[model samples]
Target chain A: MPGPGEFELIREYFTSRFQTGSRSGTADNGVELGIGDDCALLLPPAGKRLATSVDTLVADVHFPAGGDPYRIASRALRVNLSDLAAMNAEPLWFTLALTLPHSDPAWLEPFARGLAETAHEFGITLVGGDTTKGPLSITIQVTGACARPLRRDGASAGDIIYVSNQLGAAAAALPVVLGEVTVSPRQQQQAETAYYAPEPQFAVARAVEGYASAALDISDGLLADLGHICDASQLGAELNLDQLPVAVLAHSLQADAAVETALTGGDDYQLCFTVPARHRDAVQALQLPITPIGHLSEEPGIRCQWHGKPWQPRGTGYQHF
Target chain B: MPGPGEFELIREYFTSRFQTGSRSGTADNGVELGIGDDCALLLPPAGKRLATSVDTLVADVHFPAGGDPYRIASRALRVNLSDLAAMNAEPLWFTLALTLPHSDPAWLEPFARGLAETAHEFGITLVGGDTTKGPLSITIQVTGACARPLRRDGASAGDIIYVSNQLGAAAAALPVVLGEVTVSPRQQQQAETAYYAPEPQFAVARAVEGYASAALDISDGLLADLGHICDASQLGAELNLDQLPVAVLAHSLQADAAVETALTGGDDYQLCFTVPARHRDAVQALQLPITPIGHLSEEPGIRCQWHGKPWQPRGTGYQHF
Candidate 1:
């Protein structure tokens, strides 16, 4: 097979990966404008504010070295999108900074394909970016548009807390990193797929947009993440640990271990939120799979109840420092 | 002196550097509630659109090895800010992804101080970023706000051309890289300062906001960057090489060498713009040290006039690939 040069790589992977017909993507009439230009132009809707966030996935720190590039592209972009979702924003455009060891055609093909697939799924558009030669790293800065963004400081003391999707899939897959448990053929495929392709809760994010008082997508663990809410809102929470929606496989672990993993393990990509008690009915009417884990309080710090016993902070979550 | 630990180093150098007092900064309040949170909570101003751009500065590729860390931080942040300037935007916030060789407090102190100083200079605040252990590289994603952004596609065939400041300081500093010419005490200070601390033309960008038909900061060299405008606007340009503003020192070199350096050297953080002939007088009246180096043509490609002869393309600008 011919090696994928930069042009072909971008065309195949990034050109149509996100929603192409929108203001953020390539012009629908086939005008070739994107990362190739000095800058990418997006005709944003009138009166709407643009929300932006940037995150980097390093080789050894964010992802394991020599892992699948396709998965890396997918997870890296999705995690950034999750941030936009946390803001109740619609993903619009993104800029990618890719540092590669060398240009390998085999890696570029699948990687671009995965990136394209994820972008199409999210309705985002590729705007502008820089690619360089260096150690393996990918930094994606995503921009989204918000009608009304839910901020961290907006949570009142009486608001109820909620989370989207099950937590700890990526952390659960970390055994593949430590080699504590060997995967069987089927399990290897399942675990690896889950590890690489954890879904971003875009629909839930959109659903809870105006109704949410404060929201954040869980990239770090739930407890640590909720601590951000406490700090920002200057209030405390009493989380019902049993209410946490852990994955079925994770539930099989010992109670403490399951809680530990759910609380401290990172890379969940779920949305943790606070909503007023009055909006509970409206929130529940959305019919999303949400876990009402806790409620905001006048007190400061996190307190929990697990199996009717007092839940204690178990471990530190992912600390990049 | 005590060694800068990771936390204190971050607190002293990185955290305290950015000005959060302005609304464009993280929030009007001095505290960024999202620093240790799972995600940051940035309050985008109501009714205004957010503009963002990301660029990475690598060790060997972007900067010379053993280069001043303070200057590296300044240049890295300034380059990304230049993108915002091209859009006629005011920088609001930035997120940094720093990869370090080792935790050297001395290096980080200077580096952080430089980053902080630049951030304050632009009235931008550092909202949130990640620090990791890896090879030496810095990726900065800057977010700005645009009331009326000037895009590259806005230029027309009859627009007059202009550029702010001289070109090729970073490229001219290349002798320091090859070790062909030893940097003298004064030259070393100037060249190193130019190479490291590139001043983003924020004032020029703001001045040209409504007047410039199409505009972009000169990053990849004059000819190549002008080519971007031509391609975007579907037009060509005829540059007067005699009017090409070279710094006094640059003009001291041999004529051919000086022209070549001006045409091909990169890292010039000047603004290149086009204005309609009707507005030309008004633009020139700004008295901003701008030079009318060229005129846009209905034809398609860049041409330069020198000694009453058409000068061929001397060299291609910096190619990351």
Candidate 2:
């Protein structure tokens, strides 16, 4: 009920504290106007195209209610950055629209700190935003620049698919976070870290720009996300079950549970993409940490090959209905 | 519970429905890409600058909790558009971030229709956005273009002040909206119309460009908004209270209440600006419906005169604290 008002909150937590994330160190690095103006002014430089994405995280829906404020703030910003990363766009500027039930200083201080830290780390400037009184929610609109952004419909049949990092660690953390399971201190720490701060694959853009034909970050899980590419590209996929790069935490679980989680559970925030077979040598030579887990097929839907026998998984993936 | 999933929701409400707001009859006038894939792509034309602003309107805070979704959605987009008007930027495109308690079909159908109608009327496109499950709130981020945007810091001493339209109609409607008072049917309709759909003075940009020195739209009442300009420009204002333009509905009230509402109530959405004396003829020659309400001074705060006698208004303006 008691807290700083809107103007004071922005002054203390956002405006005076905005850090420029441009590497050029120039005052007018494309942001001719910011923060205090009626509208921020920007230019997309010459010859390059601009790509923009908007995402929202609601309390107790996308994240746990009353979770660590710092983790919540960091996760919100990082997930949007992951979207830009998937499109092979360089981070430029982002605007945050935050709704809060009240202006509690204790909650806002750490949230502001986390937001600043994450924005700086990702090299994205806080250009402008809105803070209003309401139930807690964070909505971010990000803008970036790139020549030819990766698209979902660019994949071709016979293209090899790749997945960044391992899957199921964040999913493994969910039960522990919801207090439905118990685990060792180390396991708990690992799962929590993976869940709270899934890294945006920033380097993948440069590594796969000219090589990967199609790409996107896995948010709703591998099966569902790949289904998106199949739907858009009008191509099917064949995944090798044994070849999946399972995270260490998932590997510790029962084999079936690990496999199921790896296939269906959400929140991985890793890139799942397809590259032409002809570019295999060039892609592998880039030496990035990615694994070939599957291949696009001329068939009309996803088909799994487990232990060299055709099989279907128990569920497709997480669905936000 | 029983509603469209995230993907279907987007397909129904956004992706399949984007249309051009461009007068050029070309699909790619300003939007390089829209409402598909991970992000929307946009570009500023040759020799133009981009302007952007984000605003949020919350249920119960900005409007009634169970208010008509059509009106609510319309008001939210219009208010943000007004900010672009103040900056003298042409309407381009906008992204919406909506949080809802659930996927209520009855609510969404009307909301989406209202959104599309208002967007078409304003000549803007729906680029991209996020829809999440949570408390009801609407956040809109608008990006536009202009050669040179008007700013709050450009007002000089001896500049004549102007208010785009009559004030206090929205304020007079508040008591009726809150059910604190009753008014004649005609008066209720007029006041409510003003409160819900306060027109953004879009003509001010072309009318005052190169003539007016400083500008901003009145959202937080006249005195408080004028204070903002003074604070930014390091100048003061002399307001002639008797000369203030009063809306018909406000004039229908008791004289004191009418003047009080006109002077102090918020939600006018009209442009308040300062024009140098030398350019006054050029500005008036534009033949816009604007009133000369005051003059700028070297002093540091606002001073008011009523019928040639010094007087004080009751309050500064609305504050969301």
Candidate 3:
């Protein structure tokens, strides 16, 4: 419902930059019709199911209300793409529903640039989007193609748990990102990079697809998300806290605080997955940057141990409400 | 990041009511996995293309902020489904991204019930959703299957344009809907019903699938939406204003005002489509309750004639910006 001039601006900044795949007459991108239509037409790849996820980021609630639009756009998309990675789905097409307080080219240009760059980097196409007037929030729905899907209900007792790369970087970076703390310039750069662009583990997902018993991306902290796998699979988990990969930025804190942040802080977007004992060797041979931090058990709850003593984190995860 | 209790509340109200299709263990629904997962897995029906659309409706901007949640939910979904109807698509699966001011059961209960009822009426399943803390708004992404798509760029110079059903009801009802005007209780009922539940033209879309050269739903009034067809098809439109099927509610106004409302009013949710001359007989034979209001022309802009004299409406359409 943007006015003529604002509509033109949207077309120029967003639609023009994403004029590839179906919109540009490409035959292999799965998009039959993209933007500038009532609905985007898509042909899902034959013999593969479509994996789809939706996430919304609200200004002030999820991220700073008037922060750098470029970084905000990057984080919004990367976090959503992480959902596809957890499902072992190869990214295909996505639709965006964006609500803005106003149409300002200064803010939009960088945001669209960041979005286009991320879409290109991930090899995904923007198929459709809606722009509305309101408080700033982004709702993105990502669709992907998957032959073998890793689901949360597939894990069994004794399955070995793994987390890709590391955790707590984004959590530790939040204070700096929010301008609440001062740090070295190099550390500031690292904080912004980790918070704004947590990489989606598509490669790890592909490697673990057929082998992992269950998988999910960590959004609401490791222990909290691990609890989801437990509830879904009707099992429990036992974590080795000493072996946890607390992120480098988090290492700036005290040893126990770093470990606690890795356990309970949110927004890391790493992949938390479980593999059966039989596939541990296979997954290990893949040599992906993953760590064996825990194992599923029949204890019916999540438990942690450090130096042969039981450990407990202060809070479980960030709560939305 | 809802707390355990709030998550339980969400699961009870929203998820429990939508326990059908894939989640209910029905293999024919094309849903491999539904809610309570990192992503929803779907198998698109063979030999059909997927048509998807996303729309976000903000409280106060799109509707009364504290109005009936049931009516709001109904209007939100219906408007989005109309996009699928414009593409000649049959309803399949959908995802919801909901932002709420707070987790109030009073609002969530009716909202979920209304959404469930509407989804049942339209035969669409809720496959995925994201709930976040923010200002109230609902973004629904609907996907459907279509054998043949109705596009905006297929109209020819001699194509006859038609509108399914009547227009101006929702626009004329806005005053009563917002409680800014006084009217009879029956009139108020009619007004609310028209505004809240504008029927999606699925049947009309099916009837015109093979015959309509170009099609789009009229959310931004006849002149504006038809201008889109003109722009895309590289043609103009000539309308016979006397033939417009203005709504009953709008007829209560003065003649010219009513006609103007029908021409420029938004939220009708009716479809304006074009059929080539060759398909006129076949389309007329379908016996739909549609009126031939206009035709495409070689000229480059929209023109209107009233009583054989040139005419112009005051405003072209609603502007979001």
Best by lDDT: 3
Relative to the real complex, the DockQ score for model 3 comes to 0.72
Q: Measured by TM-score, how close is model 2 to the native structure?
A: 0.94
Each candidate's iRMS in angstroms? 3.6, 1.2, 1.9
- The alpha-carbon lDDT assigned to residue B302 of candidate 3 equals 97
Q: Where does candidate 3 stray beyond 4 Å? A: A1-6, A21-26, A253-256, B1-6, B21-28, B253-256
Expressed as tens digits, the lDDT of each residue in B46-137 for candidate 3 is 99989999999999999899789998998899999999999999999999999988888888889998998999899999998999989999
DockQ of 1: 0.31
Model 3, A182-204: lDDT tens digits are 98999889998988898998999
Please tell me which model should have the higher DockQ, number 1 or number 2.
2
Docking class of 3: medium
Q: Can you write out model 1's per-residue Cα lDDT over A246-314, one digit (the tens) per residue? A: 765455433447767887878878889999999999999999989898899999888889899996865
Scored against the true structure, residue A41 in model 1 reaches a CA lDDT of 40
What lDDT would candidate 3 get against the real structure?
0.89
By TM-score, the best candidate is 3
Of 1 and 3, the candidate ahead on lDDT is: 3
lDDT of 2 by residue, A18-137 (tens): 843232223444876668767777766777767789988988889887788888889998899888888888888889888888898898889888988998888887889988887888
List, residue by residue over B1-321, the lDDT tens digit for candidate 1.
Answer: 434544555567665654343213435422333343334445565545556677888898888768777777888988888888887877877888787766777788788888888877888877777676678889887777677767787789879899888876667766764455775677766667667777777788788787888888888788878888898789999998888888644554334587778887788778899999998888878899789988999999888889889998668576655
The TM-scores, one per candidate, come to 0.82, 0.94, 0.97
